[model samples]
Target: MTPCGDTEGDENCIAAIEALFKAYGSLRYGEEVTQLEHALQCGFLAQESGAAPALILAAVLHDIGHMLHPDAAAAVAADQNDAHERLGAQALSKWFGRSVSEPVRLHVQAKRWLCLRHQDYWEQLSPQSKRTLELQGGAMTAPEADEFERLPYSREALQLRRWDDLAKRADHPTPSLSHYLGLARGLLQS
Candidate 1:
């Protein structure tokens, strides 16, 4: 069901992901690092923590919707919500399992959940993240929090969110895109 269909190691899927990065990965959307940098750092953090392959892949691709939708930044600037997490999840579902896609979908909600659960968490958000927080429905209410907690993969989404926050370091070193893509290729092949 991937964009390139279900063929093991589909070249079109791999090429699509590669093309996305080649085009947009170099751009920084009000962040210290480029999109690819953020992705690599996130994947590194997840891998270093010994997360499962699906979780690592989810972390690596959490922001790909931004690449897929070029107008997301302009939309945010115009006070519109593009719901990149939802977009990214939907795109990824074509190529990945629910274990990967669900966390990508819930990562935005995970941000809202963290803000509600940890009082200091709000202070840690980047300026752009702060803006998106409002656009993402602000902090979660008690009922919303309780509801979110019951969702499958919500916990992994929270972990992915944590890595998302930390992955913005300007000078973090990580493996090449092909290295991570090779890891992903294994999953795609399966």
Candidate 2:
């Protein structure tokens, strides 16, 4: 659980991920579920959906940007756009390829994409999600949506987004972070 910087091929990546959750897991993610709970649920949903290991790993680590930032919950609460998606992607990219990092990078946009594609999607979001949606550039326009859909890994991103939406059950049980770390380690380039 020691703090580890993002270094290429370092053995610390999985440990860092685990440590992050242990440290900040209890913080509410603008929802009833804590950050760690949300992540575990998202990864679990992906696994249940028969998603690839890389995709499941992406789901588990998508919000890593928030963890990388200092007082991320406070920043979100203050309405500051910390660009957690970009930050998280940058961090994950050091260990994984597009199959993993790409989806994490695009997961936020995928949320915006969903809001545009389905009218009910926006209304279904938690209050915190709705607030963050505004900061995430609101719904995508037709041209924007078209561009997003055209991007490589966009489909995966969209699927990840769906799992992200469904991952907020406070009472849901999921495998431990270590279980996922083992799965993700097999997928890591290092």
lDDT, candidates in the order shown:
0.86, 0.85
- Candidate 2's TM-score reads 0.91
Best by TM-score: 1
- RMSD (CA, angstroms), candidate 2: 2.9
Worst lDDT window (10 residues) for model 2?
A: 1-10
Highest lDDT scorer: 1
Candidate 1 ranges with C-alpha deviation above 4 Å? 1-9, 70-80
**Where does model 2 exceed 4 Å of error?**
1-9
Please estimate how well model 1 matches the true structure, expressed as its whole-model Cα lDDT: 0.86
True lDDT of residue 124, candidate 2: 90
lDDT string, candidate 1, 1-190, tens digits: 2454456447778878888889778877455888899999999999999999999999999988887776854653453568788889988888878998999999999999999999999998998889889988999999999999999999999999999999999888998889888877777734
Write candidate 2's Cα lDDT for 1-190 as tens digits.
2223344444577777887888778877765788898999999999999999999999999988887888876874575678998998888888787899999999999999999899999999887788888888999999999999999999999999999888988789899998999987787664
TM-score of each: 0.92, 0.91
